[model samples]
Target: MSAPRFGRIGEGPAAPPGGEAFSELLAGGGARVVRIASRGHADAEGAWYDQAEDEFVLLLAGAARLEFAEGTARALAPGDWAVIPARCRHRVAWTDPGRETLWLAVHLPPH
Candidate 1:
């Protein structure tokens, strides 16, 4: 048998200029785990993500804010987590400019 995989959740490549860095950590059984590193990145005005898969996001470092289509926003700090249903319209409203923000996102296949 092969050894179990090992990795750190808080470590990742640097974020790209004016963009976030994404890394796929694991995938199996129609599920994907991604690590996103962001610094001062936000969605363009009126742009939103309408994903077909359900996403569960966990804030691992720094801070951020998520805005939904319903005209509400939720702020996230380290250790905060949220489950976004599939087809939910949402966008990254803000991210910490002075520090790197790390997010662990799990995407589940559509029903």
Candidate 2:
């Protein structure tokens, strides 16, 4: 049997210049857990993400906004969360520039 581990989710380096930092915390059985750190980052104009796996995201610090291809948007604050279904077109619209915005993401097989 595998032993349990302990770690802090919010502990990580700052995002790199002009890009967010993504770290895979765990992966198994076709599911993955990731940590994302962003600061003043946003998707390129007219760009969107259409992923094959469903994503569940939770904001742990700072703030962010997500825009969808369906002409909708959602703002997220600390402790907020959202579920993006597979193939749902979306993009990171905005992130707090003054400080790092931390996120916890779980990618799961499409249902």
Candidate 3:
């Protein structure tokens, strides 16, 4: 089969807080690759992601903080990588509006 494709990053749509902007790079069977960008605000609310999927996030730019419902928090900087387990209640606590936070998100089933 042919490989999947993706558009240029600058050509992608703008993402808003509490939401995300992404461009699919690959997809097949039960796995997908996407480039995402988020500019979460200080008051951004947390959301419950699907409990059956694991997500790998790479920070490409800017800075932010991630907090989990279990009371764990971490500061994320450029080039930082985080693997959020399935069913984790997490949210962005702070973000630098002066800089855009670019992320590469890989979503896959639990290994």
Candidate 4:
């Protein structure tokens, strides 16, 4: 099998059940890059992600809404980008179901 291409990977819902699709594109030096695909996916009510790594996410296709623990929510469309600090809780609020929402996320290990 050949290595995966960022723009060529299959997108949409997870093949199994109860999850979005996540593919790790790169990992090294305590940093990781990932691709996430959401097809009408959202975080469970009151669920938040508190991570030790800082994340910078770019919306590559479709649209989404992200809510943060700081009581802020932002709509993201194609070409939109967001920088989330380490341990800053956040959650996926919504995504378009008609099409896949693709995201390129870079996770930098906390210092």
Best candidate (score: lDDT) = 1
Error of 3 at 9 (Å): 4.8
Ten contiguous residues with the weakest lDDT in model 3: 42-51
Worst 10 residues of 2 by lDDT: 10-19
lDDT tens digits, residue span 3-111, model 1: 8998887777987645699999989899999999999999997999999999999999989999999999999999999999999999999998888999999999888
Off by over 4 Å in 2: none
Give per-residue CA lDDT, model 3, range 5-105, as digits (tens): 54665456666864567778777677778786766555446563444678888888778788887788899998899988877878777776665677778
TM-score of 4: 0.84
Cα displacement (Å) at residue 62, model 3: 1.3
How far out, in Å, is residue 77 in model 4? Answer: 0.4
lDDT of 1 at 110: 83
Residue 52 lDDT (model 2):
95
**lDDT of candidate 2?**
0.92
* Local distance difference test values of all predictions, in order: 0.93, 0.92, 0.73, 0.85
lDDT of 4 at 48: 99
Candidate 3 clash pair list: none
